[model samples]
Target chain A: MPQIGGAPSGDGLQAVAMAIRILEYLAEQRGGIGVTALARALGTTKSRVHRHLRTLVETGYIVQSPESEKYRVGSRLVTLGRTVAENFDLSALAREEMRALRDTLGQSVVISRVEVTGAVVLATLPGREAIEIAVKPGSILPPHCTAQGKLGLAHAEPAVRERVLLSRLDMRTPHTITSPTVLREELARILERGWAVAPSESLLGVNALAAPIFEGGGGMVGAIAILGSIQFIEAEPSALQIRHLRQAAARISAQLGDVGRDGVDSLPR
Target chain B: MPQIGGAPSGDGLQAVAMAIRILEYLAEQRGGIGVTALARALGTTKSRVHRHLRTLVETGYIVQSPESEKYRVGSRLVTLGRTVAENFDLSALAREEMRALRDTLGQSVVISRVEVTGAVVLATLPGREAIEIAVKPGSILPPHCTAQGKLGLAHAEPAVRERVLLSRLDMRTPHTITSPTVLREELARILERGWAVAPSESLLGVNALAAPIFEGGGGMVGAIAILGSIQFIEAEPSALQIRHLRQAAARISAQLGDVGRDGVDSLPR
Candidate 1:
């Protein structure tokens, strides 16, 4: 028999587990979902699901639509979710991987979320080198000049590319690609190569090599990059650097539910 | 006196409640928080708190720091939070207020989140008028022109304001504000007056009046705006219109935990 209410079959926190599953399912759904539907989907009795739904509604984790009388994720849950996303989660997920990347390459690692205006820095790990690129968690990297930005552009939807290209590409440095045609060509190559690089583009003496991180179902969620002085990293990045970067990205992607075959073993030599 | 489990007390979902409290507390905290500390904070025994933490970590809602062994929110929680924010919560919170505003004014009402690039439209209620404003969800309002954008700029941090002003402000219409000095002056006025208006700025013959929506700590979370033909929503809106819009914003803000004295009752006549 299935365990219920600390029945000693297992940890007996099955009620909490059920409640979380209901929430996760609700988050995935579009509109109001009724108790019967939720019960059927979760493979539980209607009464058990109903009790949990009532508790959730009381706690403001979910709300009942006034008109439909069906349930949906509520404001309090959304607020908690926002707090986790804003303060902890993404950077937390990348911390170990970032540390590993930095240790392997002796280069500063930067993680960025692909936002509308630019690739916004989410986290950064300092390198072993004395002279390091000074990028923080909130820095916005220009699309035409940074490795992460270019990778984001390469994987972004067509409309996103159109919007970025339509805007005036500000020249951050002498080597920055301000022309739409040049940037477009670079983005195309980056897409094909599965990685990106920007040498002396955003900063005169800084270079970065990046690869795309994917969420489940193959959507590009963000970019992971290694930052260093041009003395070590060049416009043409070393194969070792590219491979390690891609591998790191792939591992993070796997943890994020992207279990596709295009992982480390599938990389082209 | 404190309820624990399904004893002769209210609701009897104390275990679930305690689990949620732990998650919420962890979300509010930075870095890892220990079990002893959490137990102390919750006024519960160490063993009881530990059980819930184990279940939470196993479910991936939170994780134990490998080195510190303290707990924090995990990737799953973050992913769920992003899903809720991107798909439902803010719009859901504004729906009732938006509907009320539209019913009162017969003008289209738009809700927008202040993002890095611009004020992003989260939801819209079509006006009662036959010829309604055509703005929809996901539309990006240009910072120099739209009422929502102006209101967002007024409440934004100094760095955010500087970034928008430093960028080339493309004029959408002849009346669109392009000069940084002019926009800066307008923003100052908006901040002082507690609202914003843009007439024939983003689009000719189109106008919008907007008010900021504040969160718990009075941080401007987003904006609520009324959109219509310039003939209806004039550059100088009617007092009736302004009061209604501000009231709607206030009520929504109040629901979001901004229970300060500066609410509907405190508005200037």
Candidate 2:
């Protein structure tokens, strides 16, 4: 028999798990899901799923169609999501800075944050030209591969970094950094140099440079990166552009209340 | 005593409600919330809240600082929200058409959708000039006070439109369509004319014109609108710009699989 609230039995704890599972399933489906389908997917009885559905509907986390009785993720979640996205102070502070970077460097600029599980693209400003690389906001990049991920890992606490290294790093490209020892050493070098670079590491022919943004409390809040075609970024002398990106990252860090001395020594050679 | 899981008494159901309550509380708090504060706000026992917190942590819906034990909404939600925002066909179709309209009329473009509880701005493209009025994506607007809202209501199902009329109409400015009867009549005219216009409806001296984006099925998905200072929109000969806006809206509607040839005769005078 399945564990029905045995060791997991607590004050409404099971309900919370069910709700999250329901939301996750809805999120995965994208389209609205019917009650029966949801129940089958969750491996629960229809009555149990129906009870949870009613709660979700009443709470505005999911909406039930009047005609079809299908349930979809609700608009309240969108409102809540907006609030959370805006909570990353780095996004707000980097907005104008990223725009300037795009204008100056003529390349797409993206700001990303490292959460416990992975790295999420927070904001992206496309380059002025129509043919530039586009990294849509909200795209998740593997923590062991992308430039932003390396930058984030470089700044993460030692324990957290080790845990991440221990996890499987699914290689996305032929050039992706896969070995944990190599990745660990690369992260160390990133920390020492104050920036990270991914040359065709995440996607082939896409070059990216990233620097970490620190909060006032000294924790790395996120990373600011500039991305473009290898042909463009490599062919052009990018010392000035790299300096501008670093300066912009520093400004964002300052806005997050990071008042550290200018760490010019951190820029990757 | 509160009605604790009055209708849905299953353990899983209750757990879902508690987790939603916790998220709602965190959203309101903006900054990371402590377990004690969340429990007090949610009017539940600390131990119960802690259990929910642990579940959220495991599911990646939330994360707590190792040092502080303070919890914040997780990046998983951000990734999910981005998917929703991007996959919103209405917004995607509107963005390209809005860019075209902005280029043609040199006015800011906005696409809005009516949510269950409120109106949401889904996408926005600012005009080339600094004199234009711009709405940011994810901004909320009152239904009875914006042109996009009026267009949405004009094209909504009869029952929903009636409910909106029965609801309170928040008066944002003197020009807001506040009276239910008058607003209903206005919607009728807009339906007849195939478009809607609001002169200083939500903001003083800001004029807006919008057309609905019809889905393949009969229902309206969203509305695309152009906003400008009254003096600017009126100063130009409006027939050409209005024609362009209608054509742009039609293009987006067609992209959404709206094959109806009812034409621009449905616009309001």
**DockQ: which candidate is best?**
1
> Whole-model lDDT, candidate 2?
0.72
Kindly report which residue stretches of model 2 are placed more than 4 angstroms away from their true locations once superposed: A1-12, A90-195, A198-221, A224-269, B1-12, B88-146, B149-196, B199-221, B224-269
| DockQ of predictions, in order shown | 0.17, 0.13
Model 1 chain B weakest 10-residue run by lDDT: B1-10
Worst 10 residues of 2 chain B by lDDT: B1-10
TM values, all candidates: 0.58, 0.46
Off by over 4 Å in 1: A1-12, A89-119, A122-207, A210-224, A228-231, A234-269, B1-12, B89-108, B113-119, B123-224, B228-269
- Clash pairs of candidate 1? none
Candidate 1: residue B196 Cα off by (Å): 8.9
Best by lDDT: 1
**What's the lDDT of the predicted structure labeled candidate 1?**
0.79
Compared with the true structure, what per-residue lDDT tens digits does model 2 show for residues A1-269? Answer: 22113344532366677777777678656556788888999999998888777777666566554434567665456656766666645576578888888888888899987765567898898887678797888888678888888887777668778999988888889988889999988988888777778888878898888878865446676888888888766623378766887888877665554555665535322
Chain A TM-score of each model, in the order shown? 0.68, 0.64
